[model samples]
Target: MSENRLREDLCFWAKSLFDRGLTGGASGNISVRTEDGGLLVTPTGVSMGRLDPARLSRFDAGGRLISGDPPTKEMPLHAAFYETRQSAGAVVHLHSTHSVALSILPDTDPDNAIPPLTAYAVMRVGKVALLPFYVPGDAAMAEAIRGLAGRRASVLLANHGPVVAAKDLEAAVFAMEELEETAKLALILRGTGARPLEAGQIAQVVRKFEVDWD
Candidate 1:
C-alpha cells in the first residue's frame, strides 16, 4: 500500500477500535511498519476515535522522527515488538475494560493470560503473556516484552490492557479483538466451573495454526 493508503487504513482501524469501546479517551496507540521500513504511529495524547492521518507520527528506519506529531510516550513498547519480532508489521496497544479487569484478577495465568474460551480465540491469540505492571510510559514493560524473544505476540499488561503484534495492522486489530472477547468470556465464566477446551483439543488447534505458543 502507498503511504497515503496506509495512513488512511491505520486511522480507520483506530476509529473502529475506539467506536467499539475497545479503547477510550486518549488511552490507546497503534503503529504500522511502512514499506520503507519505518513506522507510522498514532500521535501522543490523541484519541483513537479522532485521529488525523496526516498527523500520525512518522519515524525512519533508524528510529528518527521524520514528520508529523511526536509519537506516544509508550513508543518504547511499540519499538520493542518491531525489534524482537521479525514478522511483526504492526503493533496495537489498548486500554480495554474487560482485559484490564482480567489482568487485575488474582487467578489469571501469567503464562497464558486468557483462559481457553473458544476455538477462534485459541487459534488467533495463542498464549498471551500477562506481563508485570509499571507506571504509565515506563520502558520497563518494554524490556519484559523483549525478554519474550518474540515467542509470543500477545501480552496483557497487569492492571493495564492488551498489546498485540501481527503481520499487519488489520490482523493485529483482529487479534486484539479476539483477545478482548476472550477476556470478556473468561471474566463471565469465572467461578462457574466452565470447562475449557481439553488439553488435546488445544494441542490440535496449536498444531493446525502453528501458533507460536511457548
Candidate 2:
C-alpha cells in the first residue's frame, strides 16, 4: 500500500480495536511497513480511538525518524520484529482487558501463553510465547520479544498485553483479535473441566489450514 493508505488503514484498525474496547486511553500502538520500507506508525500518547492518519509517525528503514511525530516509546519492540521476522509486514500491541486478565492467572503457562483451544488461534496466531512482565516502554520488554524472535508470531507480555506480527495490517488485526478471543475462552473454560483441542487435533488443524505454527 502507499504510505498514505497505510496510515489510513492503521488508524482505521486502531479505532476498530478501540471501538471494541481492545485498547483504551493511550495504551496501544500499531505499525506497518511502508512500500519504501519505512514504517508508518501510530503516534505516541494518542488514544487509538482518536488517531489521526496525517499525524502518524514515520521512520526510515534505518530507524531514523524522517517525518511526523516521534514514534511510540515501544519503537524498538516493533523494530525487533521487522529485523527478526523476515515476513512481518505489520505489528500490533494491544492492552485488551481479557488478555491482561488471562496473563495474571496463577497457572497460566509461562512458556506457551495460550493453549491450543481452537483452530483459529492455531491458524491465526500460531504459538504465543508468554514473556515475563516488564515496565511498560522498557527496552527490556523489546529484548523479551527479541528472545523469541523468529520462533513465534505472537506473544503475551505477562501482566502487560499482547503483541502480534503478521504479513499485513488485516492479518495483524485478525491475529490480535484471535489472541484476545483465545484468552477469553481460557477464562470461560477455567475450572470447568472443559476439554481443549488435543495435540493430534491441533496438528490436524494446523496442517489443514497450512498454518506456520511452531
Give the winner by TM-score.
1
lDDT of 1 by residue, 90-159 (tens): 9999999999999998888999888877888888888899998898789998899999998889999999
Candidate 2 is scored at a TM of 0.97
Clashing pairs in 1: none
Residue pairs with clashing backbones, model 2: none
Relative to the unseen true structure, what is the C-alpha lDDT of residue 107 in candidate 1, on a scale of 0 to 100? 87
* Location of the lowest summed lDDT over 10 successive residues in candidate 1: 205-214
Encode model 2's per-residue lDDT on 112-166: one tens digit a residue. Answer: 7788898898899888888888887788987877788588888888898999999
Off by over 4 Å in 1: none
lDDT (Cα atoms) of all candidates against the true structure: 0.93, 0.88
